[model samples]
Target: MDTNIIIVFAIIIVAIFFFIWGKIRSDIVALSVVVMLITTGILTPAEGLSGFSNSVVIMMIALFIVGGGIFQTGLAKMISTRILKLAGNSELRLFILVMLVTGSIGGLISNTGTVAVMLPIVMSMASEAKTSARRYLMPMAFASSLGLLTLISTPPNLIINDALMSGGFESLSFFSFLPIGLITLSLGIMILWPLSKLLVSGKDREKASSSKGKSLNQLVSEYQLADNLYRVSIGENSPFIGKSLQELNITSKYNVSILEIRRVQSRKRFHKPVDMKLAGPASTFQENDLLYVFGNINDIMTFVEDNNLTLVDTQETEMGRNALSVSKAGGMEFSKIGIAEVVLMSSSKLINKRVKESNFRQLYNVNILGLRRKNDYIIQDVKDVKLHSGDLLLVQGKWKDIEKLTEETSDWVVAGQPMENAMKVPRNHKAPVAALIMVLMVVAMVLNIFPTVVCALMAAILMILLGCFRNVEAAYKSINWESTFLFAGMFSLGVAMEKTGASSYMADGIVSGLKEFGPTAVLAGIYIATSILTFFISNTATAVLFAPIAFQAAISIEANPYPFLFSVAIAASMCFASPFSTPPNALVMSSGRYRFIDYIKVGLPLQVIIGIVMIFILPVLFPF
Candidate 1:
């Protein structure tokens, strides 16, 4: 073997060791490989940095933002919420719906994002159904990968597509992986049903309560404010139409707190989600506006009569009055509004001030909605009550503003991380726009109107430009920098392996060993090898290393290259055996309270079966 090939191999070994060691982050390990490659003269600096500029890397970053847009706009929540309703409280129905819905969404966006947005919803369902979440979390992680239907679904898919185009082979179409995705999902749902039973030990018979932070609904229920909420609408001829909250002075005059307002935009699209705004001084009341108010029944009734408002007898209103109606997530997933508990300190300057006298709306940009003193709640005249030491005041505001309250913890302390922010979905009024952009991107890719990378970039930019995300900072934050660095850095290692002819060396060894059995056997060998490597290496890194080798193996055997490339993509992504192999797996470990043995018992079997099935199915899907 050449000395340079040996060095390249050495770096890969060290990188893999560090990846499995888990003491350092995988991205840092991959980056160390890049530095070694450049310093050893195996690759030039420009070549090492080339990975950062790769179209594959760029597309992955943009896809993160696009996925964020879908999630932040509650588009993902809407889909999961609607589909999951069919399941109700049936465990079997929940299992099927989780697999199908998560897989479907995961195919378009990254599985990590899909799992994140869906995790709370599934947990809430399990809690509501009076079952354990363990039975569902592991399978949900696997389904996220099984939904690799589109070219952008997983990083491995894009890696294979790029490898094929560079090798002078025809690139895959948008729907090329559709059949594979269907087969994977169908098998996953059926197989995981029985396997997940093992997850429900006696300890797991009941869903574990979240130790993180208080959900909005839980806060509402804790303060006994759910019973105080009322939903009323402005009648068409009401004098309140076209009037601002400041003009109405409802808070002072009526002693009723307008917590939230839901408005239907002008000429609403048939299925478009309604618009919501946190009640504020400048908020204008328009015709047919639904108001969510918190106050005494007499006060709310008098205010409604004075304003000529009609009570909206909705399930939503009954839901709040009944139990602070939770969404599929079992939390109040409000977009424009959120709540937090603020405890006043003994030494605080505002200790003796009345609620309204604190000027919280003007000073802190939050409203004092509920006050808890000792065991009793001051509901009738909240703003009139004088603040005392140890008073727990439940404040409501926009999520971002609520989060800011946590930073200044001097005179008062914000309880449990303001916003439980992850559970709050905001700006869903733009879900229609995000949904349209997603459809447009798919159509553009299918029609070949733009290059695949261009299509992805256009969609990401449009998501930011069209108000799909909260702002540009959010779009940028959506891109997981660690993964981006890891992805871009690993490309350099792939390039080094290819440049040093190390990939050919590896490919030749595989083909030479299996030549007598023909290309079919060689294809199976490559898939198994990639799967094993992915156990200790990230799927993306493994795909980067094996993709070029797969192409070389097929070319040497004079066999069709598509099957070989597709095998690499599937094997790299269908890694279920190791919790550390993928982001979704790691994400659920602590939340699901899964042990390593749990993954080994459930995921290992699924992993082996999937690989065997795909090995046979791929050759038939794409002629070998």
Candidate 2:
């Protein structure tokens, strides 16, 4: 091997060690590799920086925005609701439904987003079924992983596609991996659906059930807020129809505080009717606006009659009853409204201060809906009560504001599941437009009307132009910068490996080791290697590291590289065996009260099954 290749190999070894060590972040480790390659004279500055301008990076950013548009429009949540309706009370039926819906949707949107959207639904379903979330959450996490079978499903797919394109092969089409994806998804559902009962232990179920002992409704009853939450709609002739919250001063006039507003937008084709908006001082009350108000039952009833408003009996409508859940308040528009349980830290500045005196609402734009101190519940007049260390406050506000509150860790420690600000709102009015853009993008790619990168860019821009996303800032925020940087750095590292001949050196060893058993064994070896690497590092990083080696191995054997490349892609996504392997798995770990062994028990078998399926499928499909 050349001196440069030896140096590059040493750098990579150090990088891999750091990745597994979990001290520095993967992105930083990747960036350090790029900087070391540049400093070592292995790659020119232009070559090292080329990844920032790579088409794959641009496609990733565009896809993030497009996925955000789909999420922002509440399309995923709508699908979940419809599927849940069909699932009923059977745990088995619910598990299958969750896997099917989340997997299918994960193909189109970010799998992480799909998991975030489906989590609460699964939790609620598990609760309603009188079962533990553990019975359902592991399957849900695996389904999100299965979603990567689609070409547009996850970042690893894009990375592998870009690798193939860079190697001078025709880029894989959007549906190229459909056959394997479908088979894998079906297999996952089959294994996880029935095995959930055994894989998820009874002890775990008992622990989860005991922890979440009180349902949301039960808590509401405990707080005596059942009658305080009233759903009323503004009548066509109501005087408040054209007025803003500040203008009407409903809090003063009717002695009721407006908590949320659900308004139906003008009817559009293929769009759902209602759009939920958080109520604020500047928000206008329109005709037919559904107001969720908090006040004495008698006062609210008298105000409804006096103001020509219709009181909506929540008991009569499922939507009404759903609105009663504090966690479900921010289901519409991702960040519009959210509820969080925050615990005051021991050294919190607000520990002894009254909520009103601290100007909590003014400072954070969040309402102290309720508070819990030890065994005591303080629901009414929370603003006047003094906060204590270890006091848990149930706060409601814009998700962004709540996020800000949580970040002030010196003052508060957020309890329970970490608030995911990516909740979808009912922006179904924009769904048709968003769907049209995505369809066109897919068509353009499938037919080679444009490069995949260009098609993705056009779709992303259309999402903004069509109002699927509210603004450029929204689009910008939607992009996961960590992922973008990580991929960019990894791309450079891949280039360094190739330029320094490190990839060829590694490929020769892998090819020579398995050549006696022929190409099928070689392919299986590559897949297993990639899968093991993914268990420690990110699937994206694993794909990047292995893609070049796979291509080099095929070159050494004088056979087609497609099968080897496909194996790397498939294997990278088989990161189901570890809780830390994927974001979705980690997200569900605490809520499901799952231990690391739980993932190993469930994911290891699924990983082996997928490997067996891939070994048989790849050679036939790619003709290696």
Candidate 3:
């Protein structure tokens, strides 16, 4: 082996070690590899830095913004809600629907975002069906990976496509991989659906079977505040409309406490309501301000009647309460609201501070409706009580505000059932415009009206200009910079591998070992190798490193390179065997209470089956 090849091999091995060790961020490890390659003269500074300007990198960043717009505008949530409604009570039906919906949506949006959006819905379905969430969660996570069947489904798909294009192959059109993707997705659902029943523990099944499900109101009553918690709105003729909470002193005068205030501005008739702010001393009453108050029922009713405030009934009916509801001004209906249970982390900053002292409402924009410490539920006088680690808080606010709380994972973790109704808030009138932009971007790509990168850039810009995203900062924050840098750095490493002939050398070794076994065996070997690598590394990084080798291997055998390239793309996305393999997998790990062995037991067989199917299918599809 050449000295430069030896050095390149050493760098690659060290980089892989750091990636799996995970003591350092993957992007940082990749950048360090780039620095080493530059210093060793394996790559020029320009070559090392070329990845930053790669069109694929730019496209990935733009796609993140587009996906964020879909999320912020509640389009994804709407789809999830509709799909879940079709699930009914059958566990089998729910599993099939979840896989279909999640896979289809993930094919267009970010898989990570798809999983995040669908997670609460799936959990709620599991609860309604009286089964363990673990049974459905793993399937949902695996299904999300099916998005890779589309050209724009996941980053790895795009990386592989770019690699093929860079090697002078024709770029794949949108939906090119749909046939393979649908086949694998179908096979997965067929295999995993029955396996779930056998995998979930007996204790979980017994709990589901023995227990009669509880309603939202019944669950709230457990906190002992069913009678005290009332949703009342300030009427247009109310006397307290202009007064602040401190000035009105309703807590002392009426023996009722204002926990949260929900306000809707009438300035923009079609705009979604802003987050419900927690009622602090400085919060002033406004017309139609919905107040969640805790107090004596008689006192609250009397106070409402005395002030001409409208009482909004939130009783859980046979149809159950909608997670997101919009009430007009002057109507007795409640606005978009939600109640969530949050458990403070051991290192939470809110620990050791009274609710009032912590400015909990002002800081998090959520009201502390009740607190649970061990077996006791503190509903009355909770504001003065000091919070502690492991304390559970029942908070009430607009669904958007509660959603914001879920983002603060370092301070507290959301516990118990998710407030699904909260996710169904009114879409900004601009939601249609956002959806239209996304469609046009796809149409543009399919028609080749513009380069894929340009089309993505246009869609991202439209998301902001069309009001789907609130501002540029939101669009900016939506980009996962870590993944962006990681892609750029890995691209440089890929360049080094090609420039130093390392990829060709590896390709030769693979072709030599598998030549007697024929091209079918070669394709299977490459697929298996890439699949194993992705089990430990970022799928995008794995695709970047292996794509060139696959292309070179196809060339060595004097066969079409498309099958080899497709194998690389498909293999890189088959990361179901480890939770740490992908973000979607990790996101569901703790929620499902899944162990590493659970993934192996379920994912290993699926991976093997998919590999076997792909080896036979690839040559047929691409004619290698």
Candidate 4:
């Protein structure tokens, strides 16, 4: 081996060790590797910094903003609410619906964003449906990984696409991988759905009791005499349309409590729980009025028929309909809303800032909905609460703003919340215009109408200007620069390997060892090797390391590179059986309250199932 190649390999080994050690942040480690590679003459200064300007890196940043935009707009929550309404009928069907919705959206949005938005809603739905959230969360994570079908679906696909373009091929088309993606996604779902119960344990019994032993449904279900919530959307010809709750004899004749009255518009205005008393005297029912009433299930059924009210089987109130209509009218997913915990990081400048003084809502579009400090708690009126260091702010906002806070404001870490916020849909007239701009930007990129980075960034900026995002500060905060740095550093490493002919040399050695078994065997070898590497290294790093090698292996065997690339691509994320495998798995491992063995027990079969699906499906779709 050449001396330079030896040095380059040593740097890579050191970098890998640093990443696995998990003491320093991964971005800092990656940046140090890039600097070291440049200093050692392993790569040129331009080569070391080239990844910062790479379309793949830039696109990842913009895509994150797009995901953030969706959250800011309240679209994700709308989907969850709709799912919950339909889910009242069956848990199995609800699980399938959640997976399909998450998978489809994950393909178009950030999987992390999808998971973050859906996690609480699904947990809530699980509570309402009397089932364990464990049955659904893993599927959400897995389905998010199913974003492999489209060029714009995930960062990994974009990285691979960018690499292929760099290697002298046109970019992969938007739906190029759908045939295989859909198959793998479907098969993975089929195997996991039936086995998830047997493989993964339910919620921790002691912990569940501590939090609240009663499921939402159980809390409501026992009200055999009263206390069930009936959410009905008033229809045009409905007899209840002109009457107040008192006139309708809802509370007088039946054991019932009206929880809220919501007006659906270009935005949704929710009548507070305290406002329920006004429902009987002050309110006149209007078309599409979403009335949430609590009563005995039997009384609610009778009330609905007697008053001729149509129970809104949909989870959404008329308010959500307006949000969805705006989104669809503009051609996109509805804007999303959520509750998030933003922990004050040691380095955050806002460590001691009060919510009012911080202007979080006006500046970033985030509302400090509540505060948590150890056992201390404060409700939505946080504007009056004094801020303190180490406090975790329970915030509500468009998904993008929360994302920006977690990424850019070194002051906050995102912790999941299993609670709902008061539904207040703010009107953003720019919804349609913002959607059009984003869709156009995407279409332009697919057609090669503009540089991907410029197109996406421009659309993102326009979103900020139009109030699709609250502001540019939030947009800037949404970029995960750590992953961006990792991409740049790893790209430099790949370039060094390619320039040194190290990749070709390594490919030759691998091919010689596996040549006896042909290209199929060689592809399988690459997949398994990448899978092992991913267990130790991060998925993006593993992909960066093996993608070039996979291409070279294909050349050596005189076979199409697509199958080999596809194999490594799938294997890169199929790192189950270990906690250190992927961040998503790590997230659930901790939050799901599972031991290390829990991952091995549940994940091992899923891993085997993934391998089978990929190996069987890849050859048929891409053909060696």
Candidate 5:
């Protein structure tokens, strides 16, 4: 191989390794590849950096900001709530509705954008429906994958469509892949329908619990005991001490339901609620009954004040009332006191540390309410158990406390939302306008009213002018610049491969091996191969790598390249075999609290189903 070819392959090898190993951040890996390509003379400085200016890169960056704006304004949240309410018939029906909504919206917008917009919405609705957020998140992510069946659905499809035209083939039109894509999408959704029930089957009985750090009094309007209702404060020295509600006759005599209660004092010592005797009804009504009664507001107030039974002050409550509904909103609105699920990594300081010995609450103010070890859920007095690697903790605390915990215990990997502040997405009203502009631009481009790249550029410029990006920093930060660099680096690598006959060399080998197996087999091979590549590379890069060869193969067989090319596009875009396959997959990795094995277990089967549908349906629509 020539020096340039050697350099290109070296970059490819490093990129693939980075994707698989993933110890380093992906953007850094991409930038390193760009630097290497430039340093080795494989690409000139301008050529290596040309991806920054690539229309696709610019459009993607702009769309990310627009998507962020949508999230900030809660537009996506509003839409998801409406859709979910409409999906109230059945799980299967709900599954189909969610899939259609996600795929349809994703097709018009970017997949990552679609996911970002819908993530909080999906989690919230899942929580409301009393389902595991993990069960629904993967399906939502898969919907984004399936949306890539259309030319405008995702960046990769648009890039590939343009590349086809540049390569002397007719550009794919709107809904070009609908027949194959919809069938594949429907099959994948159906496969996922049974998954929610399967994974959460055994854990169904444990309802979501309330956190103790905040008070519930702040959540709802309060009323006091009514007039003519007897009122008494049970002091530590009171006669009714250690009496349960049944023993006290609270309901029969006073008609008091004991609506809510909170401990009057807290202990520095780690306390565990054991048997009903230790913490239950026998525990007795403590000082400050904090009783709420169903009666006239005026009457209740008069009775409580008259009897000297004071209402609990906001500061005296365990948790603010506003935070009480975290589970109620289905996971959407919750206390700012952050809650995260962390796993004990092999390197964590928490490994082998007993919860009591660790003093997590005092040190970081983070409460470890529960844990999941293997398949068992531990909600007991967990102070005794030594933490182990891979142990999952249900930690609730302030954002700063969570940050400290993550930093101090490297072995404990925080699953969702970094300790760092959320990125500042532009919140101006113009963002929706910018999004509308982008939609109009895409429509105009598809209609051949203007070049796709040019239309996208104009929309981006208009967005900047409209102050959709607050400043140059906002605009610069909005785009995933690393993706651009990766494209540039890979474009050069692809060029080098073509220049050195590496591409043709590989294509000839594949063709010769599959020729006897027929074009259908050859086509299937290309689809599967590209899909595998996508599990380790950018979808666009995967398309760029295999699209040319697919086109060439179609020519060799004297067939139109549309069906073959469509297969490559859809398959490459559905890189669901690993968490590293796509950004949405990465997002769900932490959000869904999923393990590597979980992705393989769920995604591998779904990918196979989509591949089968594509192979069987593509030829019918486009005709080989």
Candidate 6:
């Protein structure tokens, strides 16, 4: 091997090791590979960075925004729920419906988005049926991959399509994956139906707890905050007028929680008369601003007296009126103000910082109303408590503001499904517009009216313009920057492999080794190889590494590369043996309370059988 080829293989080996080790993130590993290849001079700066500008990557970003709009407007849930109602309390029907519906939607948008929209609904249905979510969720996740009907449905599809076009092969049509999707879904339904029963079959030692975290009211009652809510006002000459909430140190000094600030905007000619603002560290106090505070009356009184603030009366809160209620002013509306929970991940930067030092209100525009350390609630000195991994904080903020916490996934995970509460998705009325836009986008792609990326980008822009999301900010937040950057960065590694003859070298090794066994055997080797590789690494990465080699192998054999490329796409996608291999699989692990053994018994069998079937199926569908 040439020096460059050896260098490329070394980078690939280390990158794959990191990807499988799970110590570092796959995206970080991919970007590191790109850096090494560029720094080694194996690739030009333009070649190393070209993947960021790939059309496939752009399409992925647009599709994420479009998927976000669909979920934000509750459009996916609305359609799925009504269709699911037809199942009507039958577990078998629910299982079949979930597979078909999630797959169909997964074909149009993203598998992750499709699973997210359906997760709550599935859990709800399973609850009503008096069962664990174990049986439903894993299969539903598998079905999401099985539903890859469009070019943009999954990254592997998009990667394979890009490979074909770059290799001078005719591009696949929008619906090229339709029959493949149907076959896979149908096969999945048959195999998974019996295998998935094992998820719920035995006397499960694990309880039915989804471990999704506590509900809003549960947090209130557990912390004994039902009667602790108080609404107070900023009186004239209030010393707090000019200072931001961060400067006050009220939570630490007074031990009182200011949940939100309700402002009465003086009558304006065109704008709404009443406005509400969620209190954050940076939120400045204004004259006559009402503070929704949560604490004992004595502590509240001391703060009120010290700041020259007056206690306003409460109407009715979710906690209900109690002795602490002042009974003078209209209460803050829960429509805008809401409660959610966040648990710190092991790697959170705020782990060792005191609550005051962390500045929850200033940094995240939310207050840490309560913290759960193991089974105890830290109430008295919340501000002084140093944080730890797995510290569950009950956060209060405007629903829009709380949504921002989700963007920091590595630091903390939003506990439970608080955003799924009907009251939070205020844009539900825009479901029709969202649905129409999705329909038109799919139709345009099928008709070949524009390039696939153009059609997706147009839908994304329309979803934002027509009020399908909370705002442009929400639309932008919907895109997963990690996945986008990972794909973009890793594509350059593939380029380096091809440019350095490493891909052709591997292609020749496989071809010469197996060519005597004929194309069918070589195709089987390729499919089996891709499937095994995807078991430990991401399917997209597996597809990226193998696509070029598959294309080269077929060409060296004087055969069309379409079948070989299709095998790479299908094998890369359909891996189900391990949760770490795909996003959708890992998504259901906690929700289903599944052990690794459960995956082996359930997912591994399906994975092996699927590979076997596709080996024969791919050549028949797209002849070499």
Query: Scored by CA lDDT, what does every candidate get?
Result: 0.78, 0.71, 0.72, 0.61, 0.59, 0.76
Residue 131 lDDT (model 6): 68
Q: Candidate 3 residues 249-280, lDDT tens each?
A: 77667767887676765435345434456678
Write one digit per residue (lDDT tens) for candidate 6, span 545-570.
88888888888888889888888898
Ranking by TM-score: 1, 3, 2, 6, 5, 4
TM-scores for all predictions:
0.71, 0.59, 0.60, 0.51, 0.53, 0.56
For model 1, how does the per-residue alpha-carbon lDDT over 495-532 read when each residue is reduced to its tens digit?
Answer: 78768887657656765688679888989989987887
Candidate 4, residue 614: how far the Cα is off, in Å: 3.0
Q: Report the C-alpha lDDT of model 4 over 1-624, residue by residue, as the tens digit.
A: 999878877887787677656567656776887799899988889988887786656665665566455545554345456787886678778978887877776666545445544554565566567677777766667777665667655555666776687878667788886876787678667867886775344545314434322222222222221224467667778887767655765545654545356664433222111122124344577876777665457777777776657777544434344433433211111235444566777777775666768767556665564577787665424555677778877554555555676565566666532222212232234445545665676566556576656776777677677676555666676565665566555667666766776655655566568867988788877877777656544567667778888887788788888888877778876666654455445434333444445556666787777886687678888888
TM-score of predicted model 2? 0.59
Runs in model 4 deviating more than 4 A are 88-95, 105-178, 190-438, 441-451, 529-609, 616-624
- The residue-by-residue lDDT of candidate 5 on 346-389, one tens digit each, is 88777788865766655666656557798776644455678988
- The runs of at least 3 residues in candidate 2 whose Cα sits more than 4 Å from the true structure, single-residue gaps closed, are 83-226, 231-265, 269-294, 301-312, 315-433, 469-474, 508-624
Residue 261, candidate 4: alpha-carbon lDDT = 61
Question: What is the TM-score of candidate 6?
Answer: 0.56
lDDT of 2 by residue, 236-272 (tens): 9998888888788775566677777887664556444
Model 5: lDDT equals: 0.59
| Error in Å for residue 116 of model 1 | 11
lDDT of 5 at 483: 46
Q: Could you tell me how far off, in angstroms, the CA of residue 22 lies in candidate 6 after the best superposition?
A: 1.4
lDDT winner between candidates 2 and 4: 2
Q: After superposition, how far is residue 203 of candidate 3 from its true place, in Å?
A: 16
The stretch of ten residues in a row with the least summed lDDT in candidate 3 is 326-335
The candidate that achieves the highest TM-score relative to the unseen native structure: 1
